[model samples]
Target: MMGPAAMLLLLLLLFPVASAAGSRTLVFILAGQSNMGGRGGATNGTWDGVVPPQCAPSPRILRLSPALRWEEAREPLHAGIDLHNVLGVGPGMPFAHAVLHSHVLPPDTVVGLVPCAQGATPIANWSRGTELYERMLTRTRAALAECGGQGKLAALLWYQGEADTIRREDAELYTGRMETFVRDVRRDLAMPDLLVIQVGLATGQGKFIKLVREAQKGVKLPNVKYVDAKGLPIANDYTHLTTPAQVQLGKMLAKSYLATL
Candidate 1:
């Protein structure tokens, strides 16, 4: 019943759909500070010398570059987060691997990571309407657009609070600030039920570490969750997670994200 021209048009329309069939992209926003940017074993504070099995390369795992282009994800996921530091192993990749291979999401799904973490950044940096916050928003939007506007914001992974632990005022106000952050991020992204998985502090044992941890643990948002970093091993700097710890933390984060789904 269809003409040749109509059949040709139909085929053209179906081509893109068939090309994209059975392949979905799971987008995750990795935002926080230095630990989130990764600081694995380095040679003279430059270049990451360690790459664990959990952080191995995979074509299916992609990252948004500083130019806002999607590329194969590699270690030191946050090159756009900080220009000065050499990114090493972080929890982003391991988490992606776990989620992609997990039963929760489609096994054929491609994992997309939008890294926007900055080293030593405080929760205040992510305050709504601020420079850093605006930058994160822009980068996140760019990543979403890169997925042909078909991907989803699977989760916003946060691993900050160390810098806030340096001051009582910052720590004291962490809970309120974090509450605002969750609300604003969800509101801006138009995903009210967005999952926010916060990784509790393992570094910064002194100062207001306890207060910050309590604030992170006390968050009661609808879909917000926290992952404990207690007893996790740190690097020689005593502030960043070691290679093994990063792998373990990634798995823990993946598990937490899975529970929310």
Candidate 2:
């Protein structure tokens, strides 16, 4: 079977880049743990500072910084937001680039990425009403308002679950937690049928990884879809995705999103 990287290349060869979309910037939320925040180049307490062209900065793709400012996005996107760690290549920019060029969205549409994932956070922390959850919502609303017009939330991209795999109870109850998180976000965002793309774990920090993985895949929401990252290359830590793999995951996400339309 073709691997994700090759499949992404195939998608590129098969589709034409779109050129027109709404005038308002389309936004997406990047939520989850360290992997989602990105630990690509931070293999040993430091980021290698390598930015692949796929994940490079662009005027069309923007990131909402920790201070809620929209800036031209680059690697290590969760710099201050996912505090207490070195950052590096993440799926956010790559996803944006792929979506920008894919038939999914117009090539000219501005993509706004809201980086709200914090390293070491578990699904429980993201439950509605918690500081983590409230903050994500607050930051997203602020970021959208910064779009200079009536920007719409295109979708939400989530990559997490490592924190919940540490114990039997957490792993077992993850289905409920995961379901609630998605449901609550949709409710609060007033986007009842929002497009949600969730990345399945490539690896985990605990033995209950299988359980958490199953829960993630079991979500049966209307527009919720899962992109497998199980076989993707991992970092030296065997947890977070590497730079190239992150790019592949992004394209995979774009493929999943485009399939829905």
Which candidate has the highest lDDT of all? 2
What tens digits encode model 2's per-residue C-alpha lDDT throughout 4-48? 999978875554222111245888999999888988878788888
Per-residue error (Å), model 2, residue 70? 1.2
Structure candidate 1, residue pairs in collision: 34-119
lDDT tens per residue, model 1, 7-104? 97888566633223215878899988887888766424776566777888787788888888777788877766665787788899999888877877
Number of clashes recorded per candidate: 1, 1
Give candidate 1 misplaced runs (Cα > 4 Å): 1-22
Candidate 2 regions off by >4 Å?
A: 1-22
